[model samples]
Target: MKRKHTYKLILFSAFLAVVGCGNQEKKEVAQAPPPSIPIIQLTTKTVTGFKEYPTNIEGVINSDVRAKTAGYIQKVLVDEGQKVKKGQVLFKLETQALSEDAGAAKARVNVAQVEVDKLVPLVEKNIISSVQLETAKANLAQAKANYSSIAANIGYATIRSQVDGHVGRINFREGALISPNDATPLTTVSDIKQVYAFFSLNETEYLDFLEHAEGKSLEEKLSNYAEVNLILANGSLYSEKGQIQTSSGQINQNTGTVSFRAVFDNPNQLLTNGNSGKIQIPTVYENHIVIPQEATFEQQGNIMVFKLQEGNKITTAMIEVKAAIDHLYVVESGLQKGDKIVMSGVGKLRNDMAITPQEVPFEKAVKPIAKLFRN
Candidate 1:
């Protein structure tokens, strides 16, 4: 019975050893390495500084057409949106009353002239007093002046355009009684061949801009003088360049912003009166340290970046953001050109964390992981 139990135990032990060996063989097959978390190393390159601000486009020339005298409109010469020249007759007024008044004054002047002529012969013959002849002459002169004034009123009845531009809608149609001081405008003519962009800048920004302008090299200053661009209402860029034309005499105390007017050519007539768009004015360029926006992080109201050190350790460096350009941030301080900053996985990283940084494309490192999963 003992010998049988020993044989049974040996058999059980052999079975357990075989099972253990099979498990060891499975463990010996090397597992595939864990998937790598892609990362990017920071490198220095030339960066263009940009200032992002909202702006609008406006017409350089705009005028309201109004009636010069009160009268009933007789005829509308030009239709709305038609091109008109300066001094072109846009509307004619019913001048029947004005003409009749002028004719009546002319008849009175003729009668006065006859009396003056008759008195002139009498005064030469000394049959009448010189004072009477002089008085007759004065009466004739006053009557002629009244006739001339009446005729001038007749001329004011016709309303003409004061500028060369596209005519706006006609406010008063034929037979409508239009007044010179009416609340609504008669029409509007705008010279859309050129447009003006009006903008206001605060005193602080103005001083900084002036200082930058003065400190720049002559070539750079001249290059930036007329280097403003405009994005129109329909999201198209205006082909023409604009320049600073004039400014308001005094700074507005209430707003502390100085108003300025800039003029630009709009030969295509794409710009209209009161049309709004963005105006990109060039602020002076300076040598500033900048980094890609993907590499920057914000912590407790402080801007921070992960800088690589000698031991592949990421050191968090705080930065002062001067401005945000296209896809980057301009740093005022706390950075050097070749600091080898870790530009990816910033949220998961801590100060002095050991990282194995492989130089990866910035575009791929910044891509959303969910987007990759979807693809």
Candidate 2:
């Protein structure tokens, strides 16, 4: 009988231990805290999108200073980067050979004139035929023409600036033989008071620009187009804005792009020929939903965000991004105004996860990119 009582006691003790362990597990489950996450409410705002394209700068007029007549360079009058005016002498070529030829021709002209004078007297005295006198006069005219031609060549030896601008590198120094048929020029001069920024757009982009651009005709559209900003190679904005001047009507066969030219006034002469930069064109979108780029994450090929649902449960929401400017995105679809999305700790949240929603002001979420939305 005593052994049966001890067995009953052991069974009761095991049942009590099991009940205590179950209660402990329930207490631990009650004490667990929900994941904390910062959330932002979406809103519609006016935003402007900017698109940048590579650009190359050129002077309004680029004139090549070349040799008109073949000769050796005697002296380089102007140095590189010198500001010169029209008709300023830039180079002097050796004219010794041309001068010698002119002297010989002048002597021949004198001889021919003497013959003509002698023949006229003979003809009047009936010592020579009138046709012979006429032939002597023709010879004198021919000799004078030869001398004039040689003198003109000698004049061509002096090279002058064709326009008022800055001079470029002088290719031929003193004693360098230059020729009219030579491939390279002696130097270059560029008129840079007003500069041209050249850029290209592909076929698709060109068509889009034409469609969105204001006006019925291409010329009218270009005239009505807004001014664009230029970013220099050193990553600074150009002070003056540029206007679109014109575009190539046809596409380039090799590049599949149409070229565009924009003009900018350079009163200080800061921009020069052969400069490179980027052109920023602005497009405005009204009443568009904008979001911080940090609030969204990429999943597979689609962009996603964790949206706060009823009962503090979070669900993955896919968003369609129309354009990305700076650290913000202009959303096209898949999100609506007043919808709340997790702003921080987006990586820690999973689908249907419960979270303690820490409501953050929408302005605070996108404060870093507020300036980018300016018109």
Among the numbered candidates, top lDDT falls to 2
lDDT of 1 by residue, 1-375 (tens): 999999999999999999999988787754443223344544444454444335555555567888877899999999988889999999898999989888899999999999999998889999999999899889999999999887877888888888999987778899899887798888898788887788777888666666666436434543455467777777787788777666673579998987767788877787777678777765433555656677878899998988777766778889888777666676777886545676656778888877676766754643334544531
- Please give, for residues 25-131, the per-residue lDDT of candidate 2 as tens digits: 99999899897788899898887778899999989999999998999999999998889999999999999999999999999999999999889888999998999
Question: Per-model C-alpha lDDT, please?
Answer: 0.75, 0.91
Deviation of model 1 at 11, angstroms? 20
* Number of backbone-clashing residue pairs for each candidate, in the order shown: 3, 0
- Candidates in order, TM-scores: namely 0.81, 0.90
Task: Give the range of the ten consecutive residues with the poorest summed lDDT in model 1.
Answer: 30-39
- Candidate 2 lDDT trough over 10 residues, lowest sum: 366-375
Error of 2 at 164 (Å): 0.4
